[model samples]
Target: MFPKHVRTHHRLHHGHKPEELDFLIRRESVSGGATSSQMQREFGRLNEEEKENLLKGVGLRPGIPSGAGLLLKANLALSWNKLRHLRRWLRNWNVSLDSESKDREKAKGMTSPLVAEQLPFTFTVKGPDGKLATEVRLASCVCLEDISSTVLQRLDLLEREGKLTWHGVIPSDEIWLKIGGDKGGGSTKAVFELCNVAHPNSIENTIVWNIFQAPDRRHNIETAYKINLSQINALCGTMWK
Candidate 1:
């Protein structure tokens, strides 16, 4: 089942099963023709603050209304087979615990001006022939040492040697990532706690791990894919309020 409000709205709007709702939510589909305004009306009793947090958790902004749509959309997006798994892995990725040895302000003066944001996450792309083209991973912990010469040197070594091992990922059956920190294998954490939610076990593990990085961007093609129209309509069902 989805969150309480989401489940209520699903029944009121579509008379659908949980799996069907799950499918529709990921696709961002609307059913039974509920408009965004309708959703707002349905959730009208919620306190303004609670509503706002709920919306943000699901990726909705303030004054956008569409409470129903927002809730469904967030659930769907977060549970998305590939994107959610990737996001969870990145969030759980542990940043190095070691404090910065040097000051960032001073280092800024010495180092070359930001060449580009250090790659946010790494992914592994495999071609039809099954040869690995690139290995990309996201980190859970973000700290000063991440960009240090030591880590860079390691990355360089991996690039030259072909196949780098990145670490600090949350451990979930769906969320598989290298465990530990640069100094040593760090502690292992679970994916459910990091995301604060869980999905049915029957769901297939159909997630891909890699894609090409567009210059100066934080997300890849897999992350940018859109949900279907039905979901958008359902989510929009409460937009007007």
Candidate 2:
């Protein structure tokens, strides 16, 4: 049985209750990252299950994430956080890689030309495993009128590619869809980390590629994207090892 009864939704916002804080202190002991020997002593005070629950909450398993995987995920989470902060700078510099409809109306009010463009809309195809198979976009341009058809065809192509990608558009298993809306920068980064875990290797590269490969990136280009594709490609090769 799971040790802690706290539902994830509550824990996320409120953190463990006072009684539960002890669980965190205990779990940190057995795990290798603990900084102090005092933590090891503290673990003796808690029941075993409480210790397990705390570790699980932080995504630590005895061997599952692997030491390297945990470190990579931690670093990736940090990088993603940094990326979110750049949005203000990106907005100032005119980067419009995200959905632009909101900006269009604002621009219309000020009589500014719609600085963003409508082009072949590209988005990542996320899988149930929550990892990305391949970076794919609508095989052709998509506008509201033809979006349905383009989405269908694109999924079909993705399925044919087969080795990594999948389709049939199951909500639970597979699907063809565009990134719908911004759910705040922090939310987006959290989702990105889940996808990275789901997809693992070359996870960072795939994300960078998606942004770089987009048709209309006008402002706030991340300088990281300027590195050669071949160099980026090399990272993918080493993802799993």
Candidate 3:
């Protein structure tokens, strides 16, 4: 005999047997499309031990369709396989892109020219006492050694005319050209050719060379001699301040 509550809940209150009650519940779960929440509520009405015993006895549980669960699991596995394939493809694409970029750079380097196009600079000669001796414009491309010799020749011409006099060695081997500014980096080994130097602030694109002698003259004159070139543009003139 079925319990009164069971028969009432199953809508078989007209004194149905236990087998009829089970059949009604099974039919409600399978054919009526009962949800997981509804099944849980119905299952909760049974005692804990009874619920366990029933779960063991009935392999085909109620609520969710077995085929639906299997289908969902298969879909998830397929999605994971697609993701792994996409990741591998992206990695291969990146490697190919990097290889192409390196090849392009190598080709460019091979085709580049070696000679400097223009050599324009402004020169400032300072005496041992840190006084500005003269300022001249150089519009030719000459090596650092040639530039030093030119500066010495100019200074000699000035001395002969009684414009300036030096008590020490007339063309001191210590004389050297400092490129850029007063900031000293002993010597510049790199020689640039046919290069364009652009200074954002000024309109005059001229390299500044500060020619001076080192304070200590004991070192080898050849090794101590250093020359650097800086790109400092001349200031532009404007009427409107």
Candidate 4:
């Protein structure tokens, strides 16, 4: 008799719990970012014969998300640790892009705005004077890449023009990307590593969710939206590699 249990699905799936059907559900969800009605069709695709094998616990898991994808989902989830990351993910969008045509001959061109609206993000960088600079507002759709380029360019131009020795998030020889929020001289926001804070629409989304909320007596944590920048003055001179 053929064995009831065979490690047949391992080639297709990994790290999945056999008993839990959430993997199946998530797999359907990821299939072209399936809609609710369409994904319901996956409920009982496993036939009786297939379920018999599954019952033998000889299969791997499915719907495993990448590390970055997991983090994005976790942070955006509604929880007490509600991090205000500002970006809309296409994964959660209602419609499927796959529904459109890839054939240039058959498909008509279309465009959609990255975000439905814009938000204002205010921040400050520290100058060599050991004091904080004035408020700099990124008053529209902005991302981490924009921040990196804009901050670097603005600082370089200022220094080149003898504006003032700015010693902020710009990494020096020793320190790299030292920036945080609540920069009225001291940082009260969490010290975000370069990798941690690197994201899209983070600047604007955070501001919209965290700062643009209805004014309330208990609505605090505006500092969570804060991005203060500072660095050791002498650890590494502006001599970058």
Best by lDDT: 3
Q: Per-residue lDDT for 222 in model 2? A: 28
Worst 10 residues of 1 by lDDT: 187-196
Q: What is the TM-score of each predicted model, taking all chains together?
A: 0.16, 0.17, 0.15, 0.19
The residue pairs found clashing in candidate 3 are 116-193, 116-194, 117-194, 179-228, 180-230, 204-234
For model 3, residues 211-237, the per-residue Cα lDDT tens digits are 232222222222223332212111112
Comparing 1 with 3 on lDDT, the higher-scoring candidate is: 3
Encode model 2's per-residue lDDT on 26-49: one tens digit a residue: 444334334256566766677978
Predictions in order: lDDT: 0.35, 0.36, 0.37, 0.35
lDDT-superior candidate, 2 or 3: 3
lDDT of 2 at 234: 45
Error of 4 at 125 (Å): 32
- Pairs of residues clashing in candidate 4: 16-61, 86-201, 86-205, 180-228, 181-228
Between candidates 1 and 2, the one scoring higher on TM-score is 2
Alpha-carbon runs more than 4 Å astray in model 4: 1-62, 73-180, 183-187, 190-231
